[model samples]
Target: MPSDAYRDIASLPPALRFLAGGGEATKLILERDWSDHPLGPPEAWPDILKTTLSTVFNSPESMILAWGDQAQTFFFNETYFPLLGPRLGWAMGAPFQVVWADAWQQAKPIVEDAFAGRSRHFIDLPWKLDTDRGKADTWFSFSYSRVLSPAGDVAGLFIFTNETTERVLADAALRESQEQLRLVNATLEAQVAERTADRNRLWQMSTDLMLIAAFDGTIEAVNPAWMLTLGWTEQALIGKPLFSLIHPDDLSHTIDGADEIAAGQNFARFENRYRHADSSYRDIAWTAGPGDGKIIAVGRDVTEEKIAAEALAAAEDQLRQAQKMEAVGQLTGGLAHDFNNLLTGMMGNLELLQLRIARGRLDDAERFVIAAQAAGRRAAALTQRLLAFSRRQTLDPRATDINCLIFGMEDLLRRTVGPTTDIDVISGAGLWVAMIDATQFESAILNLCINARDAMPHGGRITIETANKWLDDRAARERDLAPGQYLSICVTDTGTGMTPETISRAFEPFFTTKPIGQGTGLGLSMIYGFARQSNGQVQIHSELGHGTTICLYLPRYAGDALMPEEEEAIATAEAASGETILVVDDEATIRHLIDEVLEEQGYTVIGAGDGAAALKVMQSGARIDLLITDVGLPGGMNGRQVADAARMLQPGLRILFITGYAENAAVGNGNLEPGMELLTKPFTMFGLTAKVAEMMKYVGG
Candidate 1:
């Protein structure tokens, strides 16, 4: 019936035959009744109009054409769909004045110039239109050109438009951001000036070998300690190349440390041998930092201490080896008992599932399948907990309101702590937003409450409070954190407290005080690692009688936070035609599984087992829409190296990093660039598909 509506399309003149393949626009043009239009029937249309229509229909950019002496009639292509609103239903072959009535006044002069044979271009031309969502403001950058007949007479107008509303708004936002950055720079300059004065006051009083050197390692000045300790007068040390006095073997490390400081990283503590006035090598421990275009350094002569340290280290190594063996044996027993139990559930169900399939017992297989899946999920969770303890787990950080997140978890917290533990929540007012992984934060809080409950062993009170804090230099140093604005979530318990020894070892992995069979000893350690990985700190306050309080301190996020209602609207990914993906993994099972999943979702997948093989595929110049790679790879190259090389070849390639843990210093330590995303191992098929869909939204945009 639909084909019958356009049955006469085949009878059109050869000049109009170009309209045959322009998708929905072509179908509408062919089926429309052109008899009453001023342009008349397609058979009578001019060759210029026909050819121009063909071009308009095939163009990938938004285009509209107006023909006839008065430029009354109009036509557009599929690319112009977005510009159409409620008028789209009657847009095809509609009068130009009726279709764009809202913008006609603003467009009239440009349209007239085009009809008079002069082309015009406009940028950020503003307009207002009534749409399904009511009135909306829009901006467009476009060009209007005249279409002429063979006689060279001005005939019609052709317009190409690109919406500039988003760009216009973004430009305004960027100006605001730049102003804010200028203010921040001013504040930093003042802070630096103040710090410099403090350092100047300490320069003469300090009893260390303090010196100022040029970036190129030329010593400029030295304090009195340098002359007293190294037998070199201040005049002798000054004007000398600092590195020339170092032992040959220490040159490379010293140079590397200098290079790092030049590249803007704070110089780490360093040690090297420096020659004394008598040509004897002195083992000097050094600390250095960049200061006002020079390197400010302090060296402590550690020759005596170094010898004592070497002897102590040798003895400590043997003690550590014996302790490690004992700890490993205990760890093995605990892990073996738990893992074996979990494996039994999984393997037993899988075996039963196979037996049922062989006996054709389809109905009985569902239970076994579910049981096996449950066991597998538990094992995956256990593995994640272990990785969390080492801060090696992948984290998906988002800007979040800590108060809102905790409010949402109130019900779960109460239910988790049980009826005996009275829960109290005190959310901080005017709390600054934080960037964190919400799921892991919730898990950490839950673990703290569980530990508190176990401490009481009876009815107790758990108070959770939040507050904004500014940690100055002294406070920050005590917490082993940098000075800054931080928000803290503190949990306190009215229960039996920990001894100083217990408190000190609380965050050590597998060092729990609970009975061996009752605890895995990873809970507190996981929380500690998670906090550190998130650029935050966790502190414990407890004594033998007083209640214990544990607080997690996270740095404040400066940017606008994405609230619940502001989540990105990402459409489910259904692969477009010819979308190809390349999957690289060392494990055959993982590679095949990814290949099958993507293939089922209508994607063409290419598989490679190692980084070298994947690079070869990239070099082959095949079209790759997405690359899914495991971070840990064999054959001398890892996933990050492959991705970096692939980006060089194809800068816009989207990457999905799949990993068991943060293994290759793990995906830039969770700082993935734009167009890149990460997925942890043991992910469900649904999670894999969903993440892929979310990332695909950035493709070609």
Candidate 2:
């Protein structure tokens, strides 16, 4: 069936034996068609071609042997597959001119010289190979020597490809010893010939980082670009282990990659870090493969690309945080506006009921009054939390003694939490005074205490401690703050602590660990916002099974502490004669409550439904003693717009603007003229009356 079935391959010359046993080469050499071959069947090849093929194939180097007068391929080894890929389909018995037509122009003269008995050596000769993936750029260092017949006439040629520096140089050195006159008269003479000058020029001029390494990991040669990129000379790179120049972190992986290349795997886009001469590292992406028992590698630097990718990630995180804050502010601000209106109506009516009971108009109303007061207080607490979470709360800051403030809350905290837990207060000696809104600071402390209490449903200790902290540059960097003095207030609780993931999001608005309905989830978020607004920081430390601690660091105020104001007793004096008060509100209950209270105080009272209605009455020349209006009212005007319009009619009107979120979100940062004051909603009846009396006093003067 085939010549191989009848002949033992080992009995043949080494070149014929190699082709007979090669996986694909054997099938191509003995099995493919050669009926039209100019040199006839492969068995009929000339003796010079047969021996030259054996010599080229037996060596562990890439080679192609072209035989006969017509230049037909007699043999090629497995290592030549990439250069001949798809071309191998017709390469078996085809003429070199037909199979390599795409590159025949550059190869024609080189082959002609070898057959003419002129030996030649070419380095880094460039060419292209057309395969399934299209034209590919390639280079080679090869030598062509004449193969002579027994009668001394030139019959064919052998091309020895120099894939790596060590193999090609070693071969060149060996040929110099035995191949004296034969190479002198053959293609070996081309090393000093004019035809090779262009190829040698190309070798020294390439800008790509190209290198050759032995299978055992010794570098053999490198191009000029390697020196430019890594600051290592070619002579320095040639004698060192290839992995020595690699980063320590990448050495083991690079060693493994070299093994893959040694096993004949072609690689592309393989990346690793390489060490530079300056003791830094450069990121490189490599393309490598095995060739002639060695490895050829090409690398491209990718340091800037990696840096750009990291920058993009950080920018994305900032955009996400900004978007999240914008969304949360819109939601919390709306809730505060609606809830404040409801609480004002409920608390105002409750106060009127209490007054009626005092006058004996109703009996058996004490229990109802107590329960309603507690519920109203709870509702007011929730409204404040929403306002703080939205960062729309108006704050009035004053320097205060932190130790005195903590001591004042002791009795109230004990009453609120019952006797289930013990309260401990530890104040620092000579602590720095903090700049904060005194009233809002108390609320922030109370919110933190309530959260700590919930974390420990069973009996536990709640410790409130204060200290003076002077943060240095390193500590300030960790907290993203400027180095300065701060007043530290810490609350510690013997409670179930939070996990790392839970702690990370603990300050996000509406994020809670407690069950639904048990918490509104705004306690920590409000505390966070308040601390930030005071030019301070808030931090939490916890573990899953241990206890938890939360710290608030407020800026140390340089000014002197203001003395706490003494509370004034409610006045029993009646309003002055002929003083008329104008009350405007959308809610009928709140409007009626104010009208009734002022009327009982012996003052004339008029009321309206909205800002538009209020302005109508003020324009009618009613000689109103004062104008009191809700900030968010129905009709085409808000409180601020209505105030602007009314001030034009009566330039010196005594206006008291009532707000929930309006002071921060609606009126913005603008100055008010004289004889104007602001009062937040959900105020006690006494507080509203006191403000009215104070304003009337100012009007009379």
Candidate 3:
């Protein structure tokens, strides 16, 4: 407990804190608040001990030292932590003998030797210690020397140790091998007498299949290892030609291998397949060499290894596909926004223009107005398809019977494709049910049939078939799908088949084999999105000049299809009813269009530029019968949050949220919240007015 002992300890000679174990060891020691330590603190250590311990703690080689007859531990470097393991925590500043009590006998002598003014060095000495691994046997090459006191008497044990277990064991094996060689030369005659029985025992116990085949490839000898690998008895295998048991696919290869080993030239490491007792193939890798005009071979079953390698390759392919889809979705998210705005303006203007023509104000411009309106509506449809392909489509999935769903579309398909094209609807017996949005499923079917019709120039056959399928792990991985029961609907057409290039990009949005302007390229992409969102998959199979087949795999739902009662459409006649409505949107054109249309219907409408403005209007005591707001707004608050805030002021506030994106977390499934209604943008005037009336009805307006 010398106060000045540590005062100059940092001043120095590498025996102080100049550098300990790469200069960072002492940093860890100083940063630690050692007030609770039994030794009080580093500041109170004796001068002679402080300087000597500091030098040992910093030495690059693993080192530790114990001071006093109590064996109070003083230092251990970072390099020595592995040797002490769990005991390291209590070993610092602790009695070394008690901390390493599990190895006390071996450790006591080393410490006592140093304290007795004697130094000891040993090579590859074994010591058992209670460590992290519990009673581990470790070996070290070490030297124990006295840590002398300032009076030149032994004060502590100075130890330097390095783990040499691996090196020492390797050296032992080499020496054993050398000794065996010397004995082999001295007893060559004795070994020859025992060789036959020894070889027979080794061959019987070996895990690798040992075989001796004639130069003509007739097997003369086989080991018990063959029974473990191929499950065939010796009597069943020995007389048979070796190539006969080889897999048919691998028989020719085996024959060629025999020819190579026939010339007495040794060969090694050839792989092929061998038939198992179960009539399946096990991949086997073999090593062969020439022995006394015969072929000596050793074979090992590698079936599991082969399967694992295949699965890894398939997983890597799936990862690459997922990355490509993610990249495409990100790039199109912005395009969806810009295109949605343009669509809103175009659709709003067309609606206004059509309204004028409907009022007989532009009787002569009716035809022109109708054409432009049709084109504008098509552009809006295109935008929706883009969103669908990006998995942003809002879906209302329910239990659906795909069998009845497809059969019910017969008349529509005939009408669309005409008489020259033949349509056959084939349904599976006891078809598995699926969970899908019925409306979207119908549209997807129509899209596929339309594509089929286009493919057949002279009008060929279009067949729609349904079947139940269960995909196992390997099969599912190949398609990047989960292993489960699935309902597959395949549409096949006798038409000009698509090339590999076309088939590869078949599901990509805006990618089509048809000439420009002839195809929007969104049909298959939209179907792909619908399937993915429904937790299903779409796959295409085709060969040039052999026609094409498009398959839609939907997850099988075990529950019976629940038929939702269709609600009679609300009449727009009572849409106004003198109710007040609040409309919030960032787009001026859309807001103005809504305000104009609703005002004409006799409802009082309040317009806001964003969520904030809408909240301000409500705060100003405006009576709102229905809240119609865009989910994404510019004033820092989205429609859902604004609606939530407004509800605090008026608990009975009814909400109707709209967005161009298929789905948003806030408005999922259009059930926004209690007293809330959900709608998507680019909606028809009739649809919009009907929704407003429905929400108003809920409020008893």
Candidate 4:
């Protein structure tokens, strides 16, 4: 079919061999065929195939041709001429095992597997070759596959090979770069995880209620504190509208905050109310801002804080009222003291005129003196009322049963409130006894009833109750009172109540909610001062459109009760004895009044306008049996200074100090010394005479 059958085999891709004449140097026919030719001497063929393969593959120029089942060597390429040196041409027809005994040891397995139809590959296979130049060491990647004949029978090994030194070095470099990248990625992942854990811990451990809400006011996330504080589970709050949990009064404000965030505005220090799990509203202060495409808000409950602020405001108002009352007391005390001195002078003059007229010297003058005395008595009563409001009125403390006190005054209270109002008295059988002035107590009850009557234009019930209460330390601390037993007398009326603002200023003098002239605001102020002076307290509770309750708390008598004294014996009486009296005062009217009163009492009176003049009189060696001086004097000398100078001159001098403004009056630094006496000025002649005689007796003692 062709020139030769071997030409068909040689025409394949791999190199092929043919025996020539005697087989010295072999012809390695690549891409050709010579099997149909007769056997000729090997020296007749040129070694061009081995030379060409070596040059193309850049390998050492040496080649071996082995064939048949015994793998006998038959030819050598001319490129292997110098490798054998002296035996080069004789090696061409030698058996492969004899020619390459050492190489066969390594190549045998590769050749056997390939011949059995298995492909074999090797990297960095080390080999040596001798050339005309020198012996050379090299590495190669070798692949071996079985060459098959046209009949599909194994023919020979076909080896494909390439040098691999540069590729092996580049492989080491690539592996190092991949390892470094892996380490870098690992480090970055660890850092990311650490930051995530830190953020999670911060979110969980916070005490403030934290929430993440969407732009539409839907709650997207909430911290544990939020759930715990609201008493809600995670699922209950997630995806719900945030305003649903807010108080009704606060929902609009909260929604506005969301609108602000969506508009790219931040809200700071927004305050509103939220509904608690217990169904009460809590004052909440929040700060909300946009964060990571969501609105993050933190809030704190401030309900107790708000209540405390309201209580503080109420207490401040009460303190202001108390201070106002104290100012009024100071004014009243000053006026009453000065007024009593003038009344004493008038009464003494009236007494002198009456004595003269009683002798039947002039009937008309006697009638005038009697009429003047009647007018003086009325003026004294008015002074007493002012003194009571000032808390300077003389008090007669007694252990009076509160139930009996209320019962005794029920008829008067009924008359005071009028026929429209019904009076009800609720008295506890085991009520505690209070030590208070009975006259002031009656006045206080009358004043409260009048107030209650004014509050109700229509008919209403008036309830008076008495109870025994033990005020513990905690209650006392809140009320600013001492811990002790108390007798409480509560007066309540079903009348129109006052607003908080009105109630706050209720006890302030001259502050009235009533139409002008319908009420005098002094009623409650007087009651407050009297109660406080009697070691008691007054509490008022009222609400708009609701009724009012006024409670009086008086200290209970804890020790053995004392017997009440006769009231008549304690009243002031005219003195009988007459003595020389020295009267010193800064006010000219006061000086003249004292001098007239003492002279009318049958005592020789010496008057000085001030303490310095009184001192001169004493230094002049006047026989002054008594020194009566106003506490506030001009010329840098007060009553006490004049008395000290006078007493130095006359060791047995009787002294009386009078005062109107006692708070500013010069007196003892702490307490009055024994035998030293003081008399508030707005007194009657009888009271003045009694005080003068009493001091003289102390001089006698």
Candidate 5:
């Protein structure tokens, strides 16, 4: 070390140079070759060097300069003048801790490390300083590094520092923003998952058959309801063409629907047939629409609706046919009565001639006598059948044990059903009795047996059973029946069962599933009419390839009569009387026949072609005893009105009304009152005679 290096140290400010004692200052000059003279004491040198270093670094207060082998305080720059309070120019030979007493405890470790050859780095250390200016909060970035002497040994320490508080706050704000963004993203993801789960639950819980099909018509997915509705497993439907499940006739439409869906069109509603797992076709109503990459279809089976529609149509047709038949019956009944009158006259005249010939007054022959009688019998039989069809024939109702009735007719039933079919009776002991017309019941049973026989052409078993049933109010409401005890006569057959279409129309008049001439299509219709007329109901159940069960529900007889043999016959004879009768009819032959029959029955008769003529005749003061008039009379006054007016003239007057067209709107349709008897047209001469006599007796009474 030369005196030249020592000279540079001595050139430092006096405050720093004074820190070096005399021996230290001399040692520094000798080691670093500073100015040769004994320049100053070591303390003075430190003070001078501290002032010089601060001036060189352009920092006033808080400046430090240290060199190798020195733990002493070296500098207090001109900036320290304000901080040192009235001792601004004081010598800088104080210890480092004493010089920075407020921060010395905190800075000691850093200072020590630096003197030991560790480089010091800046750090933000918080502190409060008491000064003449004021007490203030300050943050400092203090750095310390080792200084070297001329021999390269540790000599002193150097420190550089800065104040930094604003930078630290800015970093905290950035971290908060990042945390907020993470929360938003997490919430969005959670919402998406919840929505997906909700959608899956809704799809599973739905009851309608639902399916998702690909654009190519292959089934991509099906809900549990699909399997439940169609009776198909999930695996059976997957990857299968959706149209494959449609009925053959509906396959083309199904394909078209898929094409429309793929083209982004939605079908709001459509009806078609779908094949059930059991190979039957079910009528289905469905809505299909486009969805994400697929077609979604929802549907319900409407087979019952289709069946009910068919049944309604058939019922309407049967009603129309029944009306027609009733019209014909009226015509026939009138004709029979008129014809019988002509026969009565002819037979009376013929008997008179025969008696005259036997008394030897011959002329004309006996040939006319036989022909008239034969013709009369034939007309009577025709009238009877018409009456049967109309359900207007008199019934001989009896409390008949069905078991005996069926057993007695077993031979007849077997003969009627043919040799191939087997008849089985399963009537329970102590079976209930039904109040019914035995002949009609026999006819109905025979007709049913024949129908069953026809259904089983290849041979089958027919089971006839009779049982008592109590229909409750709830059940009655469901079935549209009157709640009461009923006698249920069931005829079941193991035969070729009818489809819904066939079964629905099975009871319609002239609507037959059998080949032409094989059936008249009147058997079931007749049975239905008979049941309804007898205050009963008929229900038929049949399924294709299964069997049929036809049940007849009749109100149980609550009266006393028990046996068919003990039952009394319906009265056919009319009351005897001789009262004036006025017969009004548009048909001349009918009018004349009625006049002749009534006159033969010992009642005075007057005829009229129309209601006006009858009224005019009555107004003319002819003492008409009974007004027997036709419902469909010419002019404004109908039979009912005519009877009303006639009764006004003659209060408490008895009327025997007649009609060829009973459905005449002017007649206020349905049956006439018991006091006003109705004689449907095309009746037998005997029927007219009896009815007229009955009315006369009623008036007399």
Candidate 6:
């Protein structure tokens, strides 16, 4: 072997210290023929190269030192034997480009960077190597660093490398095995994580209070939401009895409900108050169910909601009260203004009569008297309309056929509306009987016809229709009426209709679209009040250019209708027999007038100013045939009390009540006792006599 000749180090030249005693690799280096080599002989080598060569030859790790331009010259130690295989002998002193000729394409850039004074490392770099067996796939890890000359210029590259094929292949096999195991477990683990993550997120982040409580009301676990909602930490709530936090007033009921839940029952909703951290109570609405020896409860904070609901109810009540007050104010103002005008006319005419009679112009007195009487009548009519709007007017309800009533009023309605408007009456066949006041109904129909006539400046059609209506729940709600059979009397007009604003306030008192002096504004409102007082409803449907329909829905009377009574001519009525009557009124003028009227009818009339004066007269045991009293009196006891006292004194006494406006309770809600009747104030002398005559007849019969 060529290495046997280099055994004697003393025989070698002095400059050959780099080829000193190493192993077989150093002997082989000394025996190499380098006369024609690019680096020449070791004796002619640079000191840095020789020093680096000695280090490379003696080192244990696989290392290579490449010198010169392009790092073409190479020197390696015996460690290369395992990596380079049979190529080691020639590859030791060869240029790296030639030694790794097959891998030069991948190695060239690294060599260039080292020459440019840059260093880089690669781990598990892959390569294809030709071997005795065939092409082999291999891996290597190496670091390439620049080596500088003494002049500080990059002259070569120093590399450290190791063959890592076995370790790299072993790691790949282990990773492949691990990936197969992971794929096998992915489905079940993903499902479990999905469910657990969702539950944990809901428990930790939800706003609603969530907890698990034992069957005995002990809290086992609580979500973080307990801290956020009620200012109690999860740790504070856990192991605490749930009933301990409940309000004292709500504790018993809450315990009962919890007991129910623990007994395998579900409570859809349960409300209770819980003590907050600040010592105030919060309302909690809980939904709970029993689950496997525990109770799962979800509670929602409803304190603010409850407060808002109560506030809304209070606000609604306040609004209704405010509306009522406003209506009262409007009604009072209207009545005062209109009554003052009527009073001026009446007083002026009476004053004129007084002046004429004093001046001995007796003939002129009758006209003034007539004028004052007319004004008085007008005032009475105004009071009646106002009473209708207030829904306190006296009603004489009877079961009457609505179709016959409309037919009977057809001619009168046509004459009242004048010649311009056309009247069309479409009365329904088999119309149901309505329990309504026929006189008031006729007046309501007349008022509607007059309004329809006024609506149309030019000629238009007025339709009066009667029908049987069966209002369902939804329909009844729209009309503000209860669901039942109703007799509908509708008056429709083709005229200049009302706007939305006008229609909305059509039934409000003193709310009219007519010119100020021309309308009292009580027409529709009067009809509305009258209908409601009769247990009925009225609705107005109108549009700007279309037309208007005013409907009256009167509840159907189940009984058979009776023929209306014939009105008697009471122009010259007088008392049929001698009768003693008592008249009680706070107003002296009214009391004196009633006394004169009764006296003129050939009856003894007794007068008193107050209820006490009347009761005193009744207590005197005088023979009183009848009692006529004003409902309102100045004394502490009203006329009704006087009547009661008089009845006790004379059990068979006939009583007559009179009032400026109908006081429903004062007049027995228009349900006078037998042998009793009512007469509204401002009654004519003729009417007063007629009522007395009829009562006298009842007594005589």
The best candidate in terms of TM-score? 6
Off by over 4 Å in 5: 1-443, 456-464, 477-485, 494-496, 530-536, 543-547, 555-578, 600-602, 616-626, 647-654, 661-672, 690-699
Instruction: Assess candidate 6 and give its lDDT.
Output: 0.82
- Across 610-700, the per-residue lDDT of candidate 4 in tens digits comes to 8788888989987877888887777888778888888888886777777764432356742455566777656777778888876665546
Candidate 1 structure quality by residue, lDDT tens digits, 186-295: 56566346435645566556767887777789887677777677788878877899999989999999888888766644434578998888889989887776655567
Where does candidate 3 clash, by residue pair? 20-58, 21-58, 392-662, 394-662
* Tens digit of per-residue lDDT, candidate 3, span 458-540: 99999999999889875688777899999999999998999889888788776777876577678999999988888889999
Model 2 agreement with the true structure over 5-92: per-residue lDDT tens digits: 4235765555455344344555567677677856666677656566666565455677777776565555676567666766765576
Candidate 6 lDDT, tens digit per residue, 288-352? 87665567789999999999999999999999999999999988898898889889989999999
Give the alpha carbon lDDT tens digit for every residue of 1-701 in model 5. 43334335465455444323223233333234223323344444543344445342345335555433444644444333444442232324445665567767777787778777778677767766654445655566767887665566665676655455444433433453353234324565663464356445765677677776787888866767766677887789989987877888888887887888787675657788878888877888888766555676788877898899999999999999998798567555655565566677668767876786788866555555655666566545444434454565444466777778889999999888888999998887777678887777888888888888888989999999988888877566664679988888889999889888887777665557888547555567667766776778888998877889998888888765464434422233466456677788888988887777767767888888888888888888878778888877778778899888887777777887776543435455444454677666557687777666555655657
Ranking by TM-score: 6, 1, 3, 2, 4, 5
In candidate 2 the C-alpha lDDT for residue 328 amounts to: 71
| CA lDDT scores, all candidates in order | 0.82, 0.75, 0.77, 0.67, 0.67, 0.82
Q: By descending lDDT, how would the candidates be arranged?
A: 6, 1, 3, 2, 5, 4
Per-model TM-score, in order, reads 0.55, 0.47, 0.50, 0.42, 0.40, 0.66
Which residue ranges in model 3 land beyond 4 Å of their true spot? Answer: 1-363, 557-564, 567-575, 620-623, 669-671
Sequence-dependent TM-score of model 2 = 0.47
**Stretches of candidate 4 above 4 Å error?**
1-415, 418-442, 458-463, 466-468, 533-535, 543-546, 556-563, 572-574, 612-627, 637-657, 664-681, 686-701
Task: Kindly provide the TM-score of model 4 when superposed on the true structure, using C-alpha atoms.
Answer: 0.42
TM-score of 5: 0.40
What lDDT does candidate 3 reach at residue 546? 80
C-alpha positional error of residue 403 in candidate 5 after TM-score superposition, expressed in Å: 8.1
